[model samples]
Target: MKPVRFQFKLKYLAILALAALLLGNRGFRSLVRNYREYSRLKSEKAQLEQQRVDLEKKLAEISKKPAIEQAARTELGLIRPDETEYRFPAPKESDK
Candidate 1:
């Protein structure tokens, strides 16, 4: 009877230890989740960095004298040295 009681106590202790072991590693799942998130953010950072580089190159080109003059002349309707500038008033709601 004593041997049976000792065996029962051992089994209970083993079960308790197993439960503790499982509970002690609760952060493992979160660690894996955070690692995945970190990788995704790193990839996004790289893509954005590349886009920034591309935009900087484009900005450099646009800042050149010829490109600036062309853009101003075409998009903003700027006049050259010999051209006459014209001003037109916006139509009001009453005119419509």
Candidate 2:
């Protein structure tokens, strides 16, 4: 009876060693790190782009005189001389 033995090819071992060496290299590690940073930056850019679009829409709305007047009257408690502003108190929680 003969026992089975595993035989590894020298060329395969050399290829595996080369791969491991490359993976252990600082340059390769830095490349991986830089790629991750680039991905993060891309995500941040998307968020900033969305924010910019929202701000542009707000700016466009505020550019109109009616929108500006409405915002001012509601936000700043402003009133025109010919208009009468009414005051009301919030209803009590118990009353609800």
Global lDDT scores for all candidate models? 0.92, 0.90
> What tens-digit string does per-residue lDDT give for candidate 2 at 1-96?
433332346567788899898887899889999999999999999999999999999999999999999999989989999999788999999999
For each candidate in turn, the TM-score is 0.57, 0.74
Task: List the candidate 2 regions with Cα displacement exceeding 4 Å.
Answer: 1-19, 93-96
Instruction: Please report the candidate that would top lDDT against the real structure.
Output: 1
Query: In model 1, which runs have C-alpha deviations exceeding 4 angstroms?
Result: 1-24, 84-96
Model 1 residue 52 distance off true place after TM-score fit, in angstroms: 1.1
Residue pairs with colliding backbones in model 1 are none
lDDT at 5 for candidate 2? 37
RMSD values, in order shown: 6.4, 3.9
